[model samples]
Target: MLKRQEVKIVGMGGQGIMVIGQLLAHAALIEGANVVWFPCYGPETRGGLAECTVIISSDEIGSPVTSTPDTLIAMTQPLLDKFAPTVKPGGVIFVNTSLAQPPKYRDDCKIVEIPANDIATELSNPKTANMVMLGGYVELMKPVKLESLKASLKEVLPEHNHRFIPINNTALDKGAEVTSR
Candidate 1:
């Protein structure tokens, strides 16, 4: 059997949106899936729109861009509003309850609310909120195992930043824990 996932993650700059998307792409590749990570950047470097589309599939992928995503990960209210309507029916939306709430009108999809920022703060860095969201989405969707994601950190992150891996791992676990509850 083959598996596929089209994920659109939206957030502002400095939120590590691209990093999480890269993490997923790398993890998927590690699991023998062909993957693509396409990121978009707005005018401003910070507090500007940052979105990434990650396509992971057992077979080859023809397009890196997706008009409709099977999974939507929204880190803020505006981004959620902008992308919520585009998720395919029966898809899942992993929301950062610390910043965005699930849309009320979208009954066709499953909404998983995770207080990502709060969880990351509790873990000591608030910046790892993206990892928290990744954990939640991975727990629910299983596009790639959480362990695969953790392993990718070594490859994705620069050597000097390797020290943060432990907290990042904890954030991932915390996200899984919250979703399991």
Candidate 2:
């Protein structure tokens, strides 16, 4: 059986870190997995630093906060410096290459650098980096099915933005394809 996975996504303000947590939680819920979503509320909610954690488990979750994580997705430079040390050994680290560069340290964990923001910009939506990363995570982690993710997106995204779903789905597929390599 696949073990439950804990993921921590850290980024500066306006990076959609919290949305990533929510999306993961929703996807996990659809998968019939126990889910916990936690976000770090700060004065910089607008221009300050922000972070969110999403814990997906096969069993009941204990707490929403996580001091350690099975996976770390650092979307900014500060986030990379702050939470990179907390990632567990053999865990996966998905770094946003657009804002945050790769870390210098050599850890035992697997690290993948993705230009999610660039891809999102090319897709004509700068805010779609989170979705791009989500797609990449699905491919890299394989924690949940892509079909499940698409269904959740359809349910969660507003109806007026329905036209953008296919574009976002393509972004996800692109991200996943690159990460799968």
Candidate 3:
């Protein structure tokens, strides 16, 4: 069994961090990989700090908590500070540069600051920052194909909101392209 890639996504309430975790897990599933997704759901309904841990592996998972994640996506400043130090050596941090500032820690981990909110706003959907950041994270990780992720999104997103799918997909692609450069 191949080792799984662990990702910890952190954000405040209403950031759709849980959905982002789900999308990543589904993308892994589409690629025939094993995935375990667990979200800290309690007391998260009133603008509280929330996070979700996703493990994507070619083998079965061991635990839900990732002490040292291979990658971290922070959508808020506090989250960035709280989780930045926990990333494993040689790990990556996908930062929502629009919300979180650059961290003081500058060694071991690779940090990529992306203007997720700005890009989403430009795309006419401010709430799509999650998808935008997902794109950037995927580019940084390159664990799966971009097309596979998009296909998973199309399947997972609500049916009535299908019109926004193409826009979100483009946002994901834009983020991927920018980060991969």
Candidate 4:
């Protein structure tokens, strides 16, 4: 697996889209990689678009953005539709099939579809769908250690929110289970 990664994560507001970006950033930092987390949000606070780009590299990074990412984590159908073509050839795309229909046209890249929302619901925390997607990506590509991401939850989440760590960890583990060979 490559240590250098450029990832784009997308979902609606309040879906922990930015949280997973931060988790990746922190996980990269923990692994001693240069990293950047760039977030973009739509006008509406909770229902509109929420997305971010995460760059992780062992070498010094020149930018936090990428037009062609190594991976795409699409938490919604609209985002999957819009960004699937932006992934580079042989790259990976993780789609939340609970909401987004599978892409029918592209065959250049590997597509891993996980019903993240359904998985999260099974875990009793719908908010961790983003983490589910992240977990699967981490399991498949190993951009960072799974333990690093587990350790990063505290840093990415607020102190008052710490109580949810166990569930989040479980969600991540469940996600990994789905993709583990």
Candidate 5:
């Protein structure tokens, strides 16, 4: 188990960036870890910059803001450009290959390219791209169990949208499948 882990998820507004951070925080709480989730976005409701910073640890957190993340998930090219340098050495980065290109070669961090939008499109729900990236992150990091993430969906998603649970679950599984290889 990680003593502490800081993550930053960045993408355009309306891409469910906040949801991914919330899901991770909820799962961490369920596992008895302390978590802090902070979201920031531009004035525009959509097609604007949005990002969430999530810190999970077994001990009490010192601060909610993250200047250097242990893990960075970039869902857009602009996000990738903005946050790639902020990842600490030995950290990992997950890039949405469908919408953004990987950063220039960097020996300080590991980069995992994921075609999240393409994967979600193949799943018939492009909105699920965030969930796919989250799934891959879970599988690669093993910070929380897959089952715990599944269970947290009920709490993270609103009641009116409960019917889409199965599709999101499948998206998570598909993402895990990609990372396991």
Candidate 6:
């Protein structure tokens, strides 16, 4: 079991940042870890900045907010610039190379770059980029079981949108595959 883990996901407001965070939190819950998810966004709902912080641990959480994250998932260049320095040493950063430029090389932490938008477009949706990034993170860190994350999708997604579950699953799997290679 992980003693503690903190993840920060940042991107444009409509990039499904919150959904990824919620999915991770729910998956951690399914794994019986204490978890907290806090989301923040700018005024505009579409292009404005948005972010979510998720903390999962085996013990009680002292706080919900995290200043330094163990992992950072950035879907935009600006977001990456703003949060890259806040990652703890030996942490990991996942970048959406389709939209954001890669961060400067840092030996302290690992950087996993994925062309999320391009991958999603290949899947014909272009919106599951967040899921792709999330999948890569899951596969790289193994914070929670892949089965648990897949199962949590039904709960995180609304009933009416269940039709897209299969596609989202594919995106996640593709993400894992990309990172594994």
Candidate 3 per-residue lDDT over residues 44-163, each given as its tens digit: 566898899999888778888888899899999998999899999888888899999877675788889999999999888898999899999888677677888888877877888788
Which parts of model 1 are misplaced by more than 4 Å?
Answer: none
Each model's total of backbone clashes: 0, 1, 0, 0, 0, 0
In model 1, the clashing pairs are none
Reference-based TM-score of each model: 0.97, 0.92, 0.93, 0.96, 0.97, 0.96
**By lDDT, who's the top model here?**
1
User: After superposing candidate 6, which stretches have Cα over 4 Å from the reference?
Assistant: none
Better of 1 and 2 by lDDT: 1
Q: Kindly give the stretch of ten consecutive residues in candidate 3 with the minimal lDDT sum.
A: 41-50
Model 1 lDDT per residue over 1-181, tens place: 4488899999999999999999999998898889999999999958999999999898889999999899999999999999999999999888999998789999999999999999999988999999999998898788899999999999999999999999999999999998878
Q: Residue-wise lDDT of candidate 4 within 1-181, one digit each (tens)?
A: 2467899999888889999999989988988888999999999957999989999888888988799999999999998999999999998889999999878777988889899999999888888888888899999988899999999999989999999999999999988988895
lDDT of candidate 5 over 51-98, digit per residue (tens) = 999999988999999899999999999989999999999999999999
Task: Return the lDDT, model 5, position 180.
Answer: 84
lDDT of each: 0.93, 0.83, 0.86, 0.90, 0.92, 0.92
User: What is model 3's C-alpha RMSD?
Assistant: 1.6
Off by over 4 Å in 3: 1-3
Query: Each model's RMSD to truth, in Å?
Result: 0.9, 1.6, 1.6, 1.2, 0.9, 1.0
Candidate 2 lDDT over 1-70, as tens digits, reads 4578999988877877776677778888898888888888678538677888888888888998878898
Q: Report lDDT (Cα) of residue 40, candidate 2.
A: 89
Instruction: Give the lDDT ranking, best first.
Output: 1, 6, 5, 4, 3, 2
**Candidate 6, overall lDDT?**
0.92
Cα lDDT for residue 88, candidate 2: 88
